[model samples]
Target chain A: MEKTQIEELVAKYNEGVADPKEIKWIEQLIESGEIDLTQLRELSGLDEQIQKMEVLSPSLNLDDRFYAALANEEKQIKKGTSFSMPSLSFLLPRLAMAAALILSGFGVGYFLQSPAQKSEVSELSQEVNDLKEMMMLSLLEKESATQRLKAVSLTSEMSQASEKVTNALFVALNQDDNVNVRLAALEALKPYVGKSSVRMKLIESIEAQYSPLVQIALAELMVSIHEKKSVNALRQLLENESMPKEVKTKISESIDVLI
Target chain B: MEALSDNALMMKVKEDDLGKMSLLFDRYKRPLYGFFYGLNKEQELSEDLVQNTFLRILKYRHLFHGEGDFRAWMFHIARNVNNDHHRKKRVKATEDLDNWQERIGHHENQSNEMQHNEEHNMLSMAMDRLPEDKREVLLLSKFEEKKYSEIGEVLGCTEGAVKVKVFRALQELKVIYKQLEKSH
Candidate 1:
């Protein structure tokens, strides 16, 4: 048979579409050993070869490696750093460059202490803080809750706090959708509590928080700081009969102490 | 209850429900590993390719359109990962028959088994000798049991092209197998 005829026959045979006469012809061709059955036999033999393939088991920790990569990716996505930071290893070089820039700036400032240059040095130093604040603010505005939480953590590395940082943390605490992130934002704001705005916002957010855990955390923070202004919020929490009994008791104790 | 389909799971992945990736991985990792192994006959490289395939899926999940079979999209990524790996390493698909047998754990202790082992090794090495494109078509069609249409999707070709390629590849594979057998 011609090559096309054989291919047509083989395709039909494999698909089980060959008629009885065609099947008999294929059988006779194979039995006569005139038509090579290498392709057909090889196709059938693959099932056995596949069965015999050494059953390769990858490293036992393959899943662990995959999951670790996944988790690391999740961390990056949450931090809004997925595009910027491909891996933890990439951070080191960028950080070194930042450090070198800072050191060079200080070195330049130290040598150029003339009065006009001194003013320039102070402005440059202020620019660095402004840049840091700008980064924190942008990170805080990211949509990923994990990224927002990372922003909260990144604040701890800041050389100095600013009102903008305080405001961003307050927004995260009062309005973030994710409970853990909101709690993280509250934690970030704890050190800035000396700010009367932070104190007032923390007090005001008590009524806005629906999570009993946040309410309890707020009540504890208010009681610990002895913020006498939280008295009415605690009183309001007490009136809400749906409050978890534990939270109600905590709020009651907070109200008594505040009074 | 019917489990969520692969396309649904992939759609969830695209939507950033990344944890759903674990389910897809559980379903596909073995077959993917086998496909790579069939091409390269190397365990470490095949596993690395599998890992890379999954990583690429995660990195590019947004590109998935959720229209056709999820397996087709995934294998498309897998083929790309394998091609990239092959390019970087300059790994020719061909391996010597003895090396293939040894890697596959052929032994001379049993004469009967040795005969069978030699035939299996010849077939594998013959497969390895096929040009990469033909070998890929053959592996997808014969070993992976993917339909020509699905293979076309994975290979970025039309179904008719895949059918022609499968037929021509099988013919070439048969020639190679005959030569290997004759030499043996």
Candidate 2:
């Protein structure tokens, strides 16, 4: 393709006038891998540095964690809770899924309107709830499996003894309302959190935060202590009347694992 | 295992398989994390976005019924969650000092020589020259390895639109590169 053709397509693209065929042409260039990518970065002036910086900049480990949250999110949906996606495409997929799901849902709803089907549906919902609880437990376990710091500091020393960094992370974790930030802080705190004495407050943060994820992380940390005292602590949290049932169940499950 | 695809792991999670969540987490945590890291210089913000992304997943787990490839679904989630975050913050991500330090330090480690360092430096400099929308399309498609469809999903444009944006982004980059070459 002539360079002008590519540029014209791009102009149309910026103007929202590009045709689909022209789009495909540009994609072919990108897929062919002939173009240098650094030039395409969103933030100008950083590509040269990011490339240079790429070596020291270790890859982020948020993908798995996002998957786990998504798993919990599914459960929340089953329990009649819903969150919207910000992507414009969300409306499209959601509308499509809603159509598909609601149609199937209506068919099933009508067929199941019979007494027996209703009973069966209720039974399925119960099983689903159990599954949700079970998933919650597993998610909690996964969150606890690591000291949050294991995410960044590959070496034990780096993960620990870096008071400056740890404190910075803690401040970020507790103050950052964005769950990802808190989770990252919790992960970053992993190295420092294992201290039997100083880390007891994590359980408090878990409670105060009111986020299931932090609760899971704290519950996981406590479960690994293997000390009878820690189990008692988890049992106390599990049995606390003020604690939400979901959290209580999570605490119980983690305790069960320890016991 | 490779045998347990993303759908399978999601199925397992649905079936009360807690370990499967870890299996899923093990697979994409870094890639997703890298996604945020690419957009923001604040390591702390990247972590926060990752957490919210996961929370969104938990809240939307029912949408993850065993049919679709979970990886794409997960990215769909990440993209949405991060966009929401970017909106709420209302802060345009300018270069951070820490990012600069890390970049220069990394170059020093890779090639203590002047030439390769210049190539890396010029490339970044040229990228910094593009407009945000073009740069964003380029970043999502090139660095994030998002499909045209996925890019559209994230940016709310069509796949065709993403292709055009990418093409223009590259052309723009070429212009910047030429400008950099001439300046020297």
Give the TM-score of each candidate.
Answer: 0.46, 0.38
Candidate 2: tens digits of C-alpha lDDT, residues A1-259? 6777656655565565557786566467655543333334442233333333342123345545555555665565456645655888758887898799889998987875879878888888666655543443233323443433333233223412344444555554566555665776676566665665447655545545556677677778767655445665566555557777777788788878878
Model 1, residue pairs in steric clash: A78-A147
Which ten contiguous residues of candidate 1 chain B have the minimum total lDDT?
B106-115
Best by lDDT: 1
B-chain TM-score for every candidate:
0.79, 0.67
Candidate 2 lDDT by residue in tens digits, B7-73: 8778776665545666666666666666665555345566777677666665566677766456657
Weakest lDDT window of 10 consecutive positions for candidate 1 chain A: A30-39
lDDT of each: 0.77, 0.60
Candidate 1 per-residue C-alpha lDDT over A110-144 given as tens digits, one digit per residue, 9 for 90 to 100: 88679998788778978887877788888888998
